[model samples]
Target chain A: MKTIKSLHARHHELSDTHHQLEVLNSEIFTRHYLPTFREKLKTSGLLPLKPTGIEVFQMNVGYMCNQTCKHCHVDAGPDRTEVMTKETMKQCLEVIINHTIKSVDITGGAPEMNPDFRWFIEELRKEYSGEIIVRCNLTIILANGKYLDLPDFYKKHNIRVVSSLPFYNADKTDRQRGEGVFAKSIEALKMLNKAGFGKQDTGLILDLVYNPSGAFLPAEQSLLEADFKRELKDHFDIEFNNLLSITNLPISRFLDYLIETDNYEDYMEELVLAYNPKAAEGVMCRNTISVDHAGNLYDCDFNQMLKLQIESKAGTHISEFDLESLNERNIVINQHCFGCTAGAGSGCQGTTT
Target chain B: MQKTYYDPADLKKFGDIAEYGQDLADKFFNWYNDVFKDGALSSREKCLIALAVSHAIQCPYCIDAYTSDSIKRGASEEQMMEAVHVAGAIRGGASLVHGVQMMNKAKKMLM
Candidate 1:
């Protein structure tokens, strides 16, 4: 099942890459994609780092999401069985209690899907006393009976909600998120806004995520945010705090989409050529510690997918997390890194520029 | 369909590698800076060519970065499209050339 599943993911990738050359050649995509932005430049080694403290810790609760967006890198779906267990959540909380970690970022297919999510949040509220970030799909809250009041719940706890709304246009959003998702998401956003999620001075923080619909990194986050803010306000009457432009890493379902579509070569070449050292200076993996549902620690979610164990060697799981020891862990890396460091750079929060 | 398995999204993991030892990342890094340097090619020229080469080697990160870079450098839509085509030709040629090996085998068998 694992191999077959990986194969399915691989097929999606081939599809994305294949689209450029349906027939023999004369492909425009590859040529436009490579030789990189680095040619005619210099290359440097040993990426620099500026520590941000273990002030923030983010967890991927599971792979179950309400919307199976086409470009979703997680490949999360209704059947994925990888949600973090409540026990694991406790382990995470233990770290919060013991460490100076100031914030917690929770993400997943719809991190809200985890059965004990509400309970977990309550635990954090009562115990951690730090900022909480919830990366929501928005539509999940409207998925069914149990989730209907999540927006209000989030507001009561003062959790920061970072929602994904790919585009302002219904067709584009639906195309990416799933049929009718655009409307449902907008409705959910309304619930959030009513609770002052994106309102002025409410301190109910609401940030939106904007990832490219195709095989490209997003434009400047500031520029894209301005456009998104303008468009969403004008059309859907939607208002959010900020837009984080993430350069989608080549992994999981998104990787499969690229390969399945034949967008592989050209896209990789583009990333290589545009290899901006400036972007590399701030790749999120340098500072972020990604905790999987099972308590296994990874440098970032991308490294998690490849199962590249962190170099700390104190051991892999969260049970072994010595904040000091975890700090000692050497973040695993690979060629896929160019994506994060290529442009202005990408991270869970937004461009790291 | 011979089935190609390249993932451009992989390009997103841009700086995580040590290509050709440590120098790979370092060299690429310096070249990247040079490309953006205010000189003959302009960042736009560097972007298009990078995009083209990205196709030749097929790095998704490169593809993603250069695609954005080209647009930022003020490359016309048509020009970017044409650059991709240029890459397609080289890739196709590389692939079909293997047909010569097949042809050689077939002729030798017939002879």
Candidate 2:
């Protein structure tokens, strides 16, 4: 397999968020006669999309990852030096302590890579009793001896571990992720299972995320979940709570891949044509606020990557969080928003509709 | 006239067939939708089968439609290619089977 590098590491043009946004808003959309996501939403009676509430507070702890997965929207990789300091994490924790957010989702290039990851989680556990979700890349658990006990640590903290295992088999999974990722993921899953994360009657929740390895949109989430459950159980004796099938939004590395493969127009048309008003109404951005490593706030992770900060008058960083103002702020939309509204809809948890 | 009979864009206009014959088109599409629903043979399995038949009949539109349909139904690329191979095998076998008749006729004529 060919070695893949983060767009940022290679200093690729798409690594620049503005360049990515420009590509998304370029002439191909007009040539294809596809409506802007806002236009589509307006036609569906959903213009100026506003939040329902801030139910989930997602923090991107860092951009340093062990592996450079091709579809990463963050362009996260081993070479990335940007990581959240304990000070920034404290600011995030302060907001969590003051707010009534239902879930605190910690993500990253690999959230575990942050030196203060455990300290931050330990601190948050002390003051906030709400659900804490750590988006673990399964292989990260096996990436180093220092991280081997991650599954146990998560079990101790009762953190819901959502790991990405792109496919059940090696070939497809490794094709999207790096080679040997599948084997390590399976081993990590076994360790997670041993830690009682995905076992029956164990309150420790372990959910696997699946995004299509190609330009195509993901299949029906329930059907794909059933397939994953059966395949994992039969082949590897692995168990998990649920599967979250995410659509690869055309941004960052994925957007680069789409353009490279000459599938950009077709894939965008697919997303636009499959747009569901129902899905648009239930988009994750409506209830989730994503905070980046530096503590800046955005509607969701995708928007955070695009540098689309919250439009709230109150503030745009975690230190200046205003729940009421943030809730009223209209979500920043572009053509990429169509990815979330396509088919059954996609989000951090899975299908919205 | 267009240079070619098939335009890939025509696939998107398939629903427009209703403009010319609304009742028949409606009936055909409803039945088509029902036929692809999950049954004893899974929808994924049916998609693979349709993809193979698309190859056997050599319908460009059906080929295009079922290729995407197969992927969306979660049939792996390997599984899809195997289905096309099944169609290839059957079509090849049909031609080879007729060789037996030709051989018998030639033998009788020579005798």
lDDT of each: 0.74, 0.93
Candidate 1 on A1-353: residue-level lDDT in tens? 01123233445433243432232123433555443223312245542233344656879899777666777666677656689999999999888788887679998878998999999999989977788999988888878889999988999899999988877777667767778888888999989999999999999999998877767667677767877888788988888999887777666566656777887665666666667677666667767788988898888876665666666657788888866676755555555666777778778878877
Candidate that scores best on TM-score = 2
Tally clashing residue pairs in candidate 2.
0
Q: In model 1, which runs have C-alpha deviations exceeding 4 angstroms?
A: A1-43, A47-53, B1-111
lDDT per residue (tens digit) for residues A227-247 in model 2: 999999999999999999999
C-alpha RMSD over true interface residues, model 1: 4.0
In Å, residue A145's CA in model 2 sits off its true spot by 1.1
Off by over 4 Å in 2: A1-3, B18-20, B103-110
Listed models, DockQ each: 0.09, 0.86
Task: Judging by lDDT against the true structure, name the best candidate.
Answer: 2
lDDT of 1 by residue, B43-66 (tens): 567778888998888777677777
True contacts kept of each: 0.08, 0.83
